[model samples]
Target: MTFIALTKPQMRGLLAKRLRFHIVGVFAVSLGIAAFCKFAVAKPRKKAYADFYRNDDSMKEFEEMKKAGIFQSAK
Candidate 1:
């Protein structure tokens, strides 16, 4: 195989060319992580919240609080 030598300016140009590819790679990775958080992480957290609130009884809680004298009526 023949060896090729690059000058300083040629090396700088090559690095400049590769910088675009690196930027695109970083952008793609960040998009993938954001998608994973939105779908995998956020969806499950939202579902858990929905499931928890599905069986919630606000009136029952208010009655329990009333029984415990947590509120006082205005005269």
Candidate 2:
């Protein structure tokens, strides 16, 4: 198949249009990403549980009470 050649002015105009389209596309994409990061991502919760460790006495006490059925488990 023979290739169709574009005239110089036509090619230049096409290039400029393509460049403008790419620039606008990139700018819009960047704005979308920034907006998503600012508004869509979950913010760190101010309330977080303290780190639980087995050495914590309250955890052990609750476990023991459950095993002893002090609250009378239906099972």
In model 1, where is the ten-residue run with the lowest total lDDT?
6-15
lDDT of 1 at 43: 97
Write out the backbone clash pairs for model 1. none
lDDT of 1 by residue, 1-75 (tens): 998896655644788789989999999999999999999999999999999899999988888888888889711
lDDT of 1 at 72: 92
Candidate 2's clash total is 0
Steric overlap count per candidate: 0, 0
Query: How far in Å is the alpha carbon of 68 misplaced in model 2?
Result: 24
Tens digits of per-residue lDDT, candidate 2, 1-75, equal 999997665644798899999999999999999887766563322222233342368867888888888867632
Pairs with backbone N, CA or C atoms under 3 Å apart (clashes), candidate 2: none
Quote each prediction's TM-score. Answer: 0.68, 0.41
